[model samples]
Target chain A: MDLSLSTRNVSGPGGDRTVVEVGGEIDVYTAPKLREQLVELVNDGSYHLVVDMEGVDFLDSTGLGVLVGGLKRVRAHEGSLRLVCNQERILKIFRITRLTKVFPIHTTVDEAVAATD
Target chain B: MATVELRFSAQPEHVRTARLVAAAVARRAGVDEAVLDEVRLAVGEACSRAVGLHRSHGITAPVKVVLTEEEKNFSIEVGDGVTGTGGGAGNGGDAASGGSDGASSGDLYEGDAEGEDEMGLAVISGLVDDVEVTTGDDGGVIRMSWPTTPAVTMP
Candidate 1:
């Protein structure tokens, strides 16, 4: 399984937020790449992040851990981390881990970014 | 109903392969989408735990995965030959504390971090219908089962 990650800046009413779109499977093998990207973004001063997980086919606990770590990193900087996930399978993971309450999840990138405003 | 067994090196990358295979097996067993998702995640978690255990004990054995399909249920068992060095006994402590907060107490991001092996098990228990863990001198085994006819539907 390959995890493809791409980042783009989205300017919304909430200001410019980096949207990281992830595709494919996110297991233990592929989560490190995501962790690296997220850590790099936070270290580079980009705190407001929207993880678009609509394209993600599968996600495991390791992937969830990386997302939680990213959320903590952004929160420490007084910023917010939002998630865009519409797939039921993908969303089920957050719900199972009880992370649905921790991260603001939206159906669209616009909604996720606007929530941060 | 068919039974499939696979043995792969206890490597992180093989965990993904094992998950994919399990998903395929569940799909062939006529499992619904929701149940299939649960199976895939649960299998991945089991494989990840097995790989971590093997690495911890410096054992270079292969992890064994067995999938059994029944008329009304699908079961998966992931086994590893590496014996526990008293580490598996304390694996679930941090994971138990991290419940419902999403801030997993397990240091999953740290490559060399020890303990917290039960972090994935916590998530697996929520996804599947039933889960059982057995550990002894012959390493560890995690068996998870899901009903072919799922009771929960995606809303």
Candidate 2:
């Protein structure tokens, strides 16, 4: 079975940041695609990234790993990675992993793109 | 109790099937959307762990998933039928040591450093009401359950 998850690059709220909007279930099978996309973005010199997770229905550890890997990749280049997640379930995963304190999570792309630190 | 059992190859693609069936069962059991989401994620986590373990151990056995509904509770058990490689089961033992509630944060993300990757057991522990891991002669089994009724009071 194929999850309906897709990731595409879009302009952020401020029209400066790169935003990746992801939709559908992100499990072990689909996470690699997101990972590849994030790696490709980082390799292309796109540093500041905002992942919009409002359309994500489900997320497992594999998905979380991809996000963490992306963060590390961007951080190595002195860049920042932000996440836009408002769903209780999606936020719960971050909280469980104690990653809420590690990553900056915002409720909107506007706030995430505007965050300076 | 209505029970549904499935056995498939220990592959990543099969996790999606397990999650879909588990979600459908939870929805039909009158579980709300929030609880159904938990069920779907928890089942996916379990199946993913089983598949990863089997692959690491070079075991090509099928992973088994069982979904059972009784009263207002829904439970899922995901396991693999491969023979253990002795020390390969150590991780399962550490995970199972968290007991029935499975709320031990250490057991979930034991040695993961910041930005380090780990399994989804901790996420499963947070989403489900109860979690248990058992490693026996057959293989490792992760059992998780959730109540159909919402436990948290919504404002």
Candidate 3:
């Protein structure tokens, strides 16, 4: 089956920052692609990720676990992983898993990109 | 009563099809629009878990999803051909602790992520209000149900 999910890397407003814009359903089949993108970013030392989930229509437990794993990879290097997701359905999973507390969620890409620790 | 059965090889790619079919059947059965997303997510998690169990146990049987639209509710059952993998209310307890993501088991997310199998159930429990997980010597099934609006009848 064709993967309904797509991801693209865009240069963030600040240099060296990257935004992984993900669209379509993220489930057991497509989650590995997202995991690969995150791993590649950290491998290249490009942290401070804004996973713009504005386009994601579906996210399951496997997808959530991938995000959690990505967070661990970035934090190991003192980097941060913030999500830009305003969709209620997408946010609902984070709330259900109580991951809302673990990851900083923003409504817009700019809001997430501009926020400072 | 109406029924739809989907049987496919144990593969992650087919989980999407199962979720889509379940959501469509639920919508037709009058499931609330707002809760449709939850239904889809819950179905997807259940199907994925079944696939995982089938893959790990080397079960050649296809994963099974049965969608039933009853008078008062619409229900889904995702079945796996694996036995003795935490049956009944056994591992179901972790649905609560699943929220405690800060657990020290850092390696749980790597290499096929066996830990993720349980995490998948945690997610299913979280999304589904009325759900049940039962296993037997032959196989296991994750059943989830949602209330459906009564159909209107013209006088």
lDDT of each: 0.77, 0.72, 0.79
The RMSD of every model to the true structure, in order and in angstroms, is 4.7, 6.7, 2.6
Interface RMSD for each candidate model?
3.3, 7.2, 2.3
- Give the alpha carbon lDDT tens digit for every residue of B28-89 in model 2: 76678867777888888878877877776678878889888877687788887655423222
Q: Model 1, A64: alpha-carbon shift in Å?
A: 0.3
Question: For residues A1-117, could you state the per-residue lDDT of candidate 1 as single tens digits?
Answer: 499999999897878899999999888888899999999999999999999998898888778778878887887898788999989888877776567867789999988887844
Q: Rank the candidates by DockQ, best first.
A: 3, 1, 2
TM-score of chain A of each: 0.96, 0.89, 0.88
Q: Tens digit of lDDT per residue, candidate 1, span B1-155?
A: 33999899878988988988999988887688767767877888889878877886787878999999887888898887765444332344345445454444323433333422555776776666577777778777888877786445579
Best by lDDT: 3
**Comparing 1 and 2 by lDDT, which wins?**
1
Q: Could you give candidate 2's per-residue lDDT for residues A30-116 as a string of tens digits?
A: 888888888999999888888888888778888877887787777777788889999998898787666676678999977887887
True contacts kept of 3: 0.46
User: In candidate 1, which residue ranges exceed 4 Å CA deviation?
Assistant: B30-34, B70-72, B82-97, B102-116, B148-155
DockQ, computed on Cα atoms, for candidate 1: 0.38
Candidate 3 chain B least-lDDT 10 residues? B103-112
